[model samples]
Target: MAFSDLDFLEENFIHYAKENTQSNYANKDQVPTTPGQVKMMQELAKQVQDYGVKSRYNEKTAFAIGCLPANTAGVSPIGFFAHVDTVEYDDRFPIRPQVHRNYQGEKIILDEANGVFLDPAEFPDLRNLQGQTLISSDGKTVLGTDDKAGVVSLLAALKYLHEHPEIAHGDLYVAFGPDEEIGLGGQRFDPADFPGVEFAYTLDNGRPGDFEYETFNATAADLTIKGTVVHPGEAYGLMVNATTIMTEFLAALPADQVPEKSRGHDGFIMVTDAQSSVDRAHVGLIIRDFDWDKFLAKEDLVKNLVDRLGQKYGPDRFDLRLRRQYENIYNGVKDRPYVVNLALDSYKKAGLTPRVQTFRGGTDGNFITKKGIPTPNLFNGGGNYHGRYEYVTVEQMDKLTEVLVTIAAEHARQSQTGRDERPLKKYW
Candidate 1:
């Protein structure tokens, strides 16, 4: 499935993902900044300049540095972004990557001593990559390709256009941010600093063909309950076990609809944290769903459960707390169908059929949309993201780069027509 003369893209992409050394690498006992984050920004910025792309970079900032290409007469410049920080995982030192050389569709042996295998039963899509290359972990830690695949794809696209100057397109603004795992990516971003980026996408989705415009309407609910503590032998109704009450709250939650049990747009509630003692107890959970109405309903439902528990036990004797987190980003982009069409058209140009599914959780794209960047998300074919089981196809990474570049080119082509004038080959 490799494209003609596309070996360089695959070779360099795999090397970049492997060779990257940032806050996640094995440089010291304590996690140290590996310069991989900084290195990735510099490398891509360099490629932007070398490709005759007008771009910029930001250093000495927690948001790290970035570049947005200028939109010239024939070029439509857009930004593509991904994070450099990886989720905290077991592998904190020198890493090990298992590259399946021409995957044959069998169980992948990841750390044989530990019996770590990529079970197809667990990941049914392994059948889709019968002859493609895959990079996986040794089962001792995460694969880090969740976003590194994104970074590689952006760079590979630039390298492609750099070698072939006649591609004819608009500008590109590429970004590599830190702390996306910790959720600080858009906190320090100032879109005004990089101009002409009307719309953007984060190369942070799953499954190569996936195109995302919506993410979970996310929020959190925190609670607390109180009870009396007394000697067991002397205790009667005076001894109200706080832990027992906490268990009641947990038991009251709906079954068959949790993060692990749900799929697609199905929302669920899960207790992410809990603590208890005889005198008092505390609990917390995330309320996740794609629809905003359901999101609020879910939030109110958790609070209602807490209120009912307190009334049953006497309001003054027990306590409760609840809070909401971020909202669904669909409304921000829903009105702008062109943003979606932009993404879908790019996928089609890259030979991907373009599958659109709402994200089960929030992403930097949602935050950016709220911040006025109007961004959607693009997938890199990685599954089991944010965990040790993460894996992605090398072939998908190749297509992603092409998609990024082709989108910019296609937009530029459509720009001159101005809708009233005419249209590009398909748009017209």
Candidate 2:
């Protein structure tokens, strides 16, 4: 049986993809960050009403929230979230989505002149998409499938439940938020909007059967070194070079614990950027780890490094500012296995093998989980995301639609009978 309306899926995905709703990190102080994001989210609010849900766009938070009331009793309210904004891309070029029907496992040329091709040899995942409808960009810009595929899949699932009301379900809440790529969307989300929502799933990145509850506990650090600048000809013991201090400070960090070397449940301290001069220098870095203790240890390492450097140099020469970005979702949901089990159970019912994995990065789920509603991540059904070679199959999106619908139906069924309370295993 077909899992979703392919025609609707393709039409909606294409329509939204061309709108240029990329989020801007520089404009993050604004609610939605960009006018394009607000425009698209505002349009989405009205569209969800057609699915028979009470929907509205919150101007304050820049979130379009819709609620499909429970058709069955005894089932707890649940939610699904998808970000409307795409990552920043080359603005000189337009994003025109190309659709290929019955993709026959061949090298697809994204831009003939530019020599941008999506090959199965480089991306072997394309081999699994033979005979499926593939969508891509024109090789000049990103296809915005990172979360637009997610947005459309959530819409398809809600529309499916609307068309077939006989399929019993509890209250279903759907949220389309802005600036998730920059990490401000969920941080600004007011859980009061999703009242009584016991749990949620973010339709973000992954393959068809991917379900992730474990993610990195993240924090960003800004280290600044102050030094006295003196002319080299007159310089003696009075000249203190901030660049030298910054270099020494960076060298003190664990080289082994970094993004290039860290994988699969391992933590890392990465220096994202650094600027140095004789007078002042600044270092920007991010810390990520799955284990809480190890995460703190990484943070402490930075503080201790700064302390040691400050003592070596003058105590007033160094300043370290560390702020938490988000925490791992598993910290909140470890005791509550029902949230993880429910989605995995629904995947099986939808004829998919559940693949629970650890996300080395953080998601909107991390912030939402901190708000007392445990949120995990589900798949968005795309590959090569956030770049020119990105691609998504309509069949993959159909599978995601089925998973969403099945999750709602199974949640109701288990509520009337019993919930799957089996303990979750560490999949990493």
Best by TM-score: 2
What does candidate 2's lDDT look like per residue over 166-255, in tens digits?
Answer: 999999999999999999999999999999999999999999999999999999999989999999988899899999999999888998
**Tens-digit lDDT track of model 1 for 1-428:** 56523455456555665644435424333222455556666666665576555555566443433453433575445677777667766545444666787888888878788778897877888878888888887787777787888877776777676676666666567677765665555555667654777778888858877877777887777677778889999898779888998998899999876888988778999889999898888887888888888888888888788779878887775555555455666768766666677778777877888777777777777777887777888877667776657787778788787787777777776676542122212210
- C-alpha TM-score for every candidate: 0.83, 0.99
Candidate number with greatest lDDT? 2
Candidate 1: count the clashes.
12
| Span of ten consecutive residues with least summed lDDT in model 2 | 1-10
Regions of candidate 2 where Cα sits further than 4 Å from its true position: none
- lDDT (CA) per prediction: 0.71, 0.93
TM-score, model 2 to reference = 0.99
Error of 2 at 4 (Å): 1.8
The TM-score between candidate 1 and the true structure equals 0.83
The collision pairs in model 2 are: none
